[model samples]
Target chain A: MSVDLEKLLRPVDTPLPPYPPKVITLADGSKMVVRQIGRDDIPDLLPHVEALIHHERDYYDIVSVRVYAELLAYYRYRVVDEYVLIGQINGELSAIVNGRIYSPEIGMSYHTLGLKRGLRIGAHCFAAKMEYHIDVLKQEEVLIVAESPIGFRRWMIEYNLEKKFEIPHELGGSPSYSLTREIFNRARGSLIVGSRPVPQDLLDEAMEKILPPSDPPKAPPDFLAATRAKYDSTGTSIIADPKRKKVSHA
Target chain B: MREVYIVGIGITSFGRLEYPLVEIASYPSVVALQDAGLDTVDHLFVANMGGGRINHQTALSSAVLDHLSLWPAGSETIENGPASGSSAVKLGFQAIASGMCETVLVAGAERMSEVNQLDATDFVATLTHPMAEQIYGITLPALAGMFTRLYMEKYGVTRRHLAMVAVKNHGNAMDNFFAHVHTRVTLEGILDDRDAETNNPVIADPLHFFDMCPVSDGGAAVVLASKEVAKKLGKPMIRIAGVGQATDTHAVHERPDPTELTAVRLAAKRAFEMAKIEPKDVNVAELHDAFTILEIAESEEVGFFKKGEGHLALERGETQLTGKIPINPSGGLKAKGHPVGATGVAQVHEIVLQLRGQAEKRQVKDPKIGFTCNFGGFGNNVVCTVIKKEE
Candidate 1:
C-alpha cells in the first residue's frame, strides 16, 4: 500500500456564494456586463493581464504583474476561497477584479485592473467587488489596499475607508485599509452603480467569450515624454531630439 | 491701417503633455514656422498664465524666445486671465497692421497638469476680484454656477440644453486629433439613464461635470504678416479683418444686468463694424464655451440669436456641424481642452483652418468668414476677431 501526498499538499477552499451578474450603462451609452468567473477561466484572463505588465504609466506594470500572479495562484489551487469577476463590453474584456474570503465576517481585497482606460470601467468593477463582499456575502468588512494613485483615489478617498494599520495586507507589508459596512453605506449612492437582472442577450454575449480589450494602456512611444513630464527643468532633452519625429502633436 | 493676415497656424494635442513649459510653447512655434517656410519673425508674443506660481518659471517670453533660438527678435508675454491667447493675437495683428513690424509670431501655451487639481483650481480662482470675490472663496465654477442659475431663471435654459451643448461638442471632438476629450457622451448616458447621476455628478449647482471645460496643457501658434508678405507666401489668404476688445466692471455684482454679457455684445459689435459685416454673414463661429451656458449666452450677445432664444436654435439643431452658421466645428473650449493661455490662439487656429478649407472632417461647408469670441474673467474683458478668406 502507497500513501498519497498530492491531496495533502493542497489547501481546501471554503464554499462561498456566487456573485450575481449585473449590467452598467457606461457614459458612452454602452452596456457592460459584470459577472463572477470560476477558476477554470483564469487562463483566459492571463494573457490580457500579462500584456499590461510592461506598461509604465500609472503603475500599471506592478499592478498587472501582481494580478497575473494572483490569477495563476487561484488556477493552481495555491490560494483558497478566491473569487474572480470580469467586466465585458460587447463581449470584450474591459476590467478584472478579484478578492478572497478571509473569514465568515471578513474579506481580503486583491486587485482591480481596468483594461479600458478612460471611461471609469475600473471604478465600476471595484464597486462591484465591494458589493460582492458586503452585500452578497454579508461580510462585516473588506480589507483593501491600493497599489496606484488612481486606485488610492477611488478606494481610500472616495470610500473614506478606515485605517486597519495593525493588520498588514497580503500583497505587501503595507498597512491595510478597511472598508467597513458603515463606510460602504455612506458612500453607496454616488459611488456604487449598475442594475440587476441583466437582459439575456447581453448576459449571453458576455458569457460567450472574453475577447481582447480594444484599446488598453501601453508604453509611451517616446521615453523622453515621460522623463520630461516628471522632471527636466533644463528642456535640453526635447531640443536635442527635435528630428525624432515623435512630438505627439497629433 | 494695413491688412493683417494669418499666414500659418499650428497646435499641439490638448491633454497631459509631459514636457517643459517653454518646450510646450516652442513646439508649436516650430510647426508654425515650418508651415510658413520662415526661419524667424520680426517679433514674438507669448501668451501664458500661472507660469510663476504653478510652474515656478517666469519671464516666459524670454525663455521661449531663447529656446526657439530666435535671439534678435523682440519678445513679450501677455497675461489677460483666460483671454491671454487672443490678446496676444490681437497685439500681433496690431504690430503688423500698424506697420511696426512686417511679421509677428503669436504663441500661447499652458501647463496646468503640472500641479494637482485643487492647486490648478486655486490658480484659476485667483482671476476673480480680490477684495470682493476672493475674500468669499469664490471660484470660477461657483461664478459659472451662479451665472447659469440666473440664465436658467431668466432665459428658461434647462439642463437638457446644457447637455446638448456637451454632447454636440464631445461628438465634434472625436474628429479632432488634438482635442483633449475624445470620449463620446450620449443624452441617455449623461442625463436620462439611471447611472447618469453617478456618471455626471453635480460639480456646481445646476452645472454638471460635463458642462465645464477640462483643465488642459497645450500650445498653439499663428504667424501674422502684412498683406504683401501674405501674397508672397502663396498660402491661403486668411486675413484678420477685425479685432475688437472691450472691458467691464471687474466685480460681477457691479454689472447693470447680471444676466447680460455686455462686454461680449460691445466687442462683437465693434468687430462687425470694423469688418463691415453683420452676424448673419458669418459662415462659422468659435465661441468661448468654458461653461455650456456661456455658449448660449454668448451666442445671443454676439447677435447670433435673440437674447433668450439661443437654446431654441440649439433645439432646432441650427448649431450642429451641418446646421446654419455651425458653431465650434473644432469642438470649442468645452471639448477641445482649455489651456487658458492657449485657448484664444487655438480658436483663431481653428478659424484659419476653416477659412483655408483645411479642417478635414469637421470642416464647415465652404466657410469664407469665421468669428471667434475670447472671453476673460467672467466676461469682464473680451476680445472678438473676425477673419475672412480672400480669393
Candidate 2:
C-alpha cells in the first residue's frame, strides 16, 4: 500500500521550490487544486479513474486491468522519466493527468484500440502525455523527446510539434512522430494542461519508487459494488468554505 | 376543408424480413398502389427513423421512390422518431386536404435488425439529452424500466400484471399472419426464463427481453386520396375523421410525472374534440405498445382507463381481443414488431383493417370506429388519429 518515489527522482534531485498550484474553476464555482502526484495520493486518484471510465463507457474502449498493471509496472520498474498529476476539489481527487518522456526506443509499445485508432491518434496521444510531462518540467529547463504513432503526423502539424522523424515497422501499421522541447513549448499554450507544475523527473522517480516490486495486486471480489456501497455509506463530505457566505469576486 | 379518405392500405408482415431497406419499403408501396387501384400517384412521403443510422443512408425517400420506379414525382422523408409513420400520414393528409395533390402515397419502413444489438441500442439512446442522460449511460429501455418500476411502486401493480400484456399481444399476434413474433408467452414462462439464449433476456433492469418489442424490419403504406378520387377507386374507404399532433419537452427529467405521458393525453383530447366523439365512441384502439409497460401507461394517458388502472385492466383481460374496446388486436408492436418509422402507419393500417371488418381471426366484432396513438421519443411528441368506417 506504500510507494517510495524518491529514489526514481533522486537522479534529478533539486531543491523543492515554491510554485502556485493549478486551480480549475468548475461551472458551479467550485475550484479544484492540481498538484504533482505523491506517494500518498492513491486513494484520492482512484475515484477520478473510476468516474472517467464511467463517463467514457459509450465513447472509448478502456484497457483491461492486466494492461493497466503492465503500464504501472513499466512506469515503476522501467520508465525513470515521466510525469503524473492529480487534481483535487474540496480535498478530494477530481481528475488525473499523467504522461511519460518517450524515446524512440521506448515509444513503440503503447497500446491503442477502438476509436483511438487512425494516424492522428498517435500525435494526439503523445500531445496529451507530453502536456503532463511539461507540467512536471516546470523550471527544470530540460529538453524532452517523445514519439507519436504514425498517422498522427498531422498532430505534429496541429500542435506545431516539430517531427524529429518517423519510426518504421512500429506497433500495428502506425508510424511514430518524434517531438522535441521547442515544438512542445510552442504547442503548450494552446493545450489546457490545468494547474500543476511538478518536475517531470520527480514524477518519473515517484512512479518508479511506488510501484509494487513483485506480482500485480490480487483481483478484488465485486470491487465495483463494494466501492459504490462504501461511497454511499461514508457520508464524508469535503468542506469547501467554512463561512456560509458565498465568495463573490464581481 | 377538403375531405381526405384513405382509399388504400397495405402492410407487409409485421415481423423480421430478409429483404434490404429498399425492398422492404417497396413491397408495401407497391401493394398500396394496387390496393388503391392507381397506376400513378402525385407525391410520395417516405417514413423511416433508423435508415440513416442503421443503413447509413440519408435522403431515403428518394432512394425508395427511385427503387420503386416512381421517380419524377415529389418525394420527401419524414422522421419524428418512432412516430415517423404518423407524421407521414399527417403530411399526406395535409397534401390532399390542401388541394395540392389528388393522391399521395405515405409509406413507413424500418430495417433495424441489420445493425448489432449494442449499436442499435446506442443509436436509440442518442434520442435522449446528450449532455445529461446519454453521458450517464441512460437508454430508452432504462427509462422505460424506471417508469415501470415507479408505476408498480405507486400503483401496486405486479410483474405478473405486466406479463399479461405480452401474453395477450402475442396471442393476438398468433391470429395475425404478418406478426413478426407470435407465440403464446405465459407469466410463468416469462418470469422463470433465466437463460438469456432461450428466453428474452433482460435488456434493462426490471424489463425482461420478452417485455420489449422486437427490432423488426417491415413497412406499411396508406394511400390518401380526395373523396372524389376515393369514390371512383370503388374500394371500401376509411375516413380519417380527426388527427391531432402535440409535443412536450424532450427531456424526461423535465416532465412532472414520468409515469403519465402528458403529450398523449393532449393529443388524444384534440383528436376526440376534432372527431366530435369521446374515448367511448371508438370501437377499438391500436396503441403504441413499444414495451409492455408502455401499453399500460399509454392506455391511461389516452383516457382509456383511470390513472393506474391500465395494469388492472390488462390483468383482467379487459384489453384483450374479446375485451371491451380491444387494444392491439393486430398484436401491437410488442408482437407485431416495431419497425420504428413503420409502427405508426402500421397502427393506422390495423385500424383500417378493423374498420373494414377484415382483420380475420383478430378482428374486433362489429368495429365501426378505430383510434391509433403514434408516439415519438417517449411521449415527447404524439399524434393521435381517429378513423371511422364509411357507409
Interface RMSD, one decimal, each candidate = 7.4, 34.4
Instruction: Quantify all predictions' global Cα lDDT against the true fold.
Output: 0.90, 0.67
lDDT of 1 by residue, B157-259 (tens): 9999999999999999999988988889899888998888777889899999899999999999999888888777777999999888999989898998889
Model 1 lDDT per residue over A94-162, tens place: 999999999999999999999987677999999999999999999999999999988998899878899
Per-residue CA lDDT of model 2 for B220-288, tens digit only, reads: 999888888887877797888889999988888788887778899999999899888899888899999
Off by over 4 Å in 1: A1-9, A219-250
Top candidate when judged by DockQ against the true structure: 1
lDDT value, residue A179 of candidate 1 = 97
User: What's the interface RMS deviation of candidate 1?
Assistant: 7.4
By summed lDDT, the worst window of 10 consecutive residues in model 2 chain A runs over: A233-242
C-alpha TM-score for every candidate: 0.94, 0.60
Clashes per candidate (backbone, < 3 Å)? 0, 13
Clashing pairs in 1: none
